[model samples]
Target: MTPGARIAAAIDILDAITAGAAAEQALTQWARRSRFAGAKDRAAVRDHVFDALRRWRSAGAAGGGQSGRAVMIGLLREDGTDPAQLFTGERHAPEPLSHDEAQVPEPTPARGVRWNLPDWLLPEFAESLGAHAEATAQALQSRAPVTLRVNLRKASRAEAQDALQAEGILCAPNPLCATALTVTEGARRVKQSAPFAQGWIELQDAASQAVVAALPSGARCLDYCAGGGGKALAMAADGRTTFAHDIDAGRMKDLPSRAQRAGAAIRLLDRAGLEQERPFDVVLCDAPCSGSGAWRRAPHGKWTLTPERLAELTAVQDSILDTAKDLVGAGGHLVYATCSVLRRENEDRIAAFLAGHNGWFCRLEQRFDIQQHGDGFFTAHLTRVKL
Candidate 1:
């Protein structure tokens, strides 16, 4: 497909998305109907759709209206491209712009639009990050880096890097963790790479890996909210006895296979199983949150999150911390983590947890900011004063 054709496809998908269809579903629908579109065409169209989502407010403003055509026009204009080239009346291209649409309007001078965030979230970001809020907001407007964690249980960092490079999946060491690698090129080839299929590597954000690296070594560990068992598998790579559990047991249906593929032994526990195996040496609660830090990968979440939803998430976080604490024995680490940049979800939750419980104090804490390397993540290590 021509570049103009791709833009036209993006506009249609965006229109469907604006009309309440999910971005992924809309894109899938488009792909299903347009069997003539090649892989690169589909990828380009998907990129355009997500880029518009990441800067929806700003793009809508610049494009002169809320419609998908206007937003695509605005996106092209924002990138200093001539929208006229893509919105031509030629075959397979977007319709020619109307006279009013031809005139690009100056974007409204609103912080919410400027930062491409919901109006209610602007103050939250400000309160959470202060001076770094703008940078963090800007970072979320771009794509996240593709990162992988070397399964040290299978291969050394150097060895994994070499194997990945052999398959054209270029990578460099990530500073967030010794076992982490940021894919520099050919990231799309990673799934087909021999290293990945052989369990020499696993795709995970560097910041997420850093959270595991920060945990105090223990003979036995439990991931209380182990959705997909990423952290549980990571912990097991160190030869620790790792157990995984989630309130929704269905979320871990693939965990057993994943653990086997990674050559890591991770025991899956239901509520009854967890109750039977009391008091682990370390318990990690990777609670759910607004997912603000990962908005780059799931931009639809930014628009969908509401104050009520955030409140509900905070309550869940608190409850998880409260329940997971019971499974931590004396002197054991109760690690709380979230992939959210908002303090209300991270530090504030930790503060509340410490306030409600006696004898427990945070021993170490770290916040990984969104940068060229990884998504924002916060983790804190809490231990009962070992009395």
Candidate 2:
């Protein structure tokens, strides 16, 4: 498909999203119908849709409206591209811009609009991130880097890098963690690559890898809120007797296969199983949150999150910590983590947990800010207070 055709496809998908369809759902529907579109065409169209979503407010303001066409126009303007190029009236292209659409509006002074975030989130971002809030918001407007964590249990970082490079997947060492490799090229081929098939690497954010790397020494570890078991797998690779449990056991249906592929042993536990395997040396609670740090990968989340939802998430975080604490053995560590940049979900939650749990005290706390290398993350290590 022509570049113009891709833009037209993106406009249609964005329109569906604006009409309440999920971005992924709309994109999938379009793809299923447009069998003639090639892989690159579909990828290009998806990129355009996500790019516009990431800058929804600013794009709408610049284009003078919130329609798909207007937002596309605004997105192009923000990117320093002339909308006329892609909106040409040629076959398969978007309709030509009207005179009003062609006029570029001045940039908005409102921080929320300028930062491409909801108005309600501005104060939260400011309070959570301080001077870095605007920069962090700007970072979310672009695509996230493709990072991989070398399965040290299978291969050294250098060995994994060599294997990935052999498959044309260029990579550079990520500074966030010794095991991390930032995919510099050929990211689309990673899943099909031999190294990945052999479990030499797993797709994970560098910061996420760092969170696992910072874990204290322990013979047994339990990922208390293990969703897909990414951290569980990582911890298992460290040679710890790792166990994974989630409230929804269905979320870990594929974990056994994943663990097998990575040559890591992770015992999956239901509530009853968890009770039997209690008193672990370390317990990691990677709680769910607003996912603000990962908005670059899931831009729709930023738009969909509400104050009520955030409050609910914080409550859940607190409850998870409370429950997970009892499973830690004497002198064992309880780790709390989240992939949110908001303090309300990170430091504030830790404070609340410590306040309510008298025998626990925090030992270490770290915040990984959103950058070109990785998403924002927070981790805190807590242990029982000795009398």
Candidate 3:
């Protein structure tokens, strides 16, 4: 398909998303219907769709309307691309811009539109981030970098780099963690690369990998909220006795297979089983949140989050922390983590926990700001002062 055709496809998908269809579902439906579109065409179209979503408010302002055509035009303009070229009336291209449509409008001074976030969230971001708010907001307007976590048990950093380079997957070490690698090129080929296929590397954000690295060492550990078991698998690479548990047991169905691939022994535990196993040396609670920090990868989440939903999440985070504390053995560590930059979910939650619980005290707290390479993340190590 021509570049114009790809833009047109993106416009349609964006319209579907605006009409309440999920971004992924809309993209999938488009791909299934347009079977003639090749792999490159599909990828290009998907990129356009996500880019538009990431800057939806700004694009709408620049394009002068909420329609898919106008938004696509706005997105192209934002990227400094000539909309006339892609909106040409050529075969398979979008319709030519009308006289009025050609006159792109200046973006509104509204903070949400300018920041490409919900209006209510602007103040929240400001309150949470303070001086760094604008930088964090701007970072979410683009794509996230592809990163990988080298399975230390399977391959050394040098060996993993060599294997990735052999398969045309260029990478460089991430400063955040020893096991982290920033994929410099050929990221699309990583899943099929020899290193990744053989479990030498696992796709994970550098910040996420750093969270595991900072965890207190213990002979026995439990991932209290192990969704997909990424951290559990990371912890297992060190030959620790690892156990995984989640509120929703179904979420861990694939963990056994993933553990097998990584050559790590991770015992999956249900609620009953978790109760049976009284306490662990270390318990990591990678709780759920609004996912504001990693919005670059899931831009739809930024728009969909509401104040009520955020309140609900904070309650859940508190409950998870309180429950996970019980599973931490005497003098053991209970780590709380979230992929959110908002204070209500990160530091605020920690503060609340410390206030309510008498015996626990925070040992270490760190926030990884969203950078050109890594997603926003916050983690805190809490140890019982007296047990």
What tens-digit string does per-residue lDDT give for candidate 3 at 291-322? 99899999999988999999999999999998
Q: After aligning candidate 1 to the native by TM-score, how far in Å is the CA of 110 from where it should be?
A: 1.7
Give lDDT for model 1. Answer: 0.92
Residues 136-214, candidate 2: write the lDDT tens digits: 9999999999999999988999999899898899999999999999999999999999998999899999999999999
Top lDDT prediction, candidate number: 2
Which segments of model 1 are wrong by more than 4 Å? none
lDDT of each: 0.92, 0.92, 0.91
The collision pairs in model 3 are: none
Candidate 1 clash pair list: none
Arrange candidates by TM-score, descending: 2, 3, 1
lDDT of 1 by residue, 1-387 (tens): 989999999999999988999888999999999999998899899999999999999999999988889889999999999899888868799989899989879668889988999999999999999999999999999999999999998899999999888878889999889999999999888988899888888999999999998899789999999999999989999789999999999999989988888999999998899889978999999999999999999999999899999999999999999999989988899999999999999999999999999989899878999999999999999996777
For candidate 2, the C-alpha RMSD (Å) to the true structure equals 1.1
Instruction: Name the lDDT value of residue 80 in candidate 2.
Output: 90
TM-score of candidate 2 versus the correct structure, residues matched by position: 0.98
Give the least accurate 10-residue stretch of model 1, judged by summed lDDT.
101-110
